[model samples]
Target: METRQEAVTGTIGCATAVLGAFAGIAVWFPYGRTALFGAFEGETNPTDLWLGLPVLALGGAATAVAVLTAVQGRRRIAVGLAAATAALAAFGYAFDVLAAPQALQDCGSPC
Candidate 1:
């Protein structure tokens, strides 16, 4: 007897988890030296590798939980997880947009 809302939330949560995982991987294995390059594209920086690894792990875990909860008919939990994931995604994207220019400016080419 799962509600439609719960199903939707579960789906969203799963999507968010996937997105987060990708973002985390990108951060950890950046293709470029600067965050700006990596933000929009697939760039990696050795120095920041450590920082991104944890995010990747967390994203994967969250995604797993969301999927499990959804499957178990825990609609409320799934929805909450999805909402949180959406919020995090939104904030991360915003930060990338706002921070890109600054990162580029700081690095000054070859970034």
Candidate 2:
């Protein structure tokens, strides 16, 4: 049985996780697309460390806290958050490890 406080915490955690995941995806989308397709399109997409690095760091922190909260009291929400967080983490990883590098490479000497 979950107390009211626990329920509220879980709810907030779930919501935060969802929002964080959405935010992560939102931030990654443009860069990811540019990195993946810009070269072929004859356009150079440069990675913005200023914007991307902070968002990824913050989103990661938020997701970690949310997952901890959900695991403490809400099994159902935990599962959902786990999936969402996984996707967010994977997407972030791809953006950082693969996409960013590709984008940088595409930039040549001027980026």
TM-score of every candidate: 0.44, 0.43
**1-111, model 2: which lDDT tens digit per residue?**
889997997687677656765766566666656654555535544554444545564565467665675667767766775676677567657656325444355566765
For each of the candidates, the C-alpha root-mean-square deviation to the true structure, in angstroms, is 8.6, 7.6
lDDT of 2 at 31: 66
lDDT, candidate 2, equals: 0.60
User: What lDDT tens digits, residue by residue, belong to model 1 across residues 1-111?
Assistant: 999998997797677667757655665444223542464344434333333355444655565667667887989998887776666556545434223323444665676
Give the Å shift of residue 102 in candidate 2. 3.9
In model 2, the runs with Cα more than 4 Å from the true position are: 41-95, 98-111
Candidate 1 lDDT at 40 equals: 32
Q: Give candidate 2's error at residue 18 in angstroms.
A: 1.1
**Which candidate tops lDDT?**
2
TM-score of model 2 (CA atoms):
0.43
Off by over 4 Å in 1: 1-56, 97-111
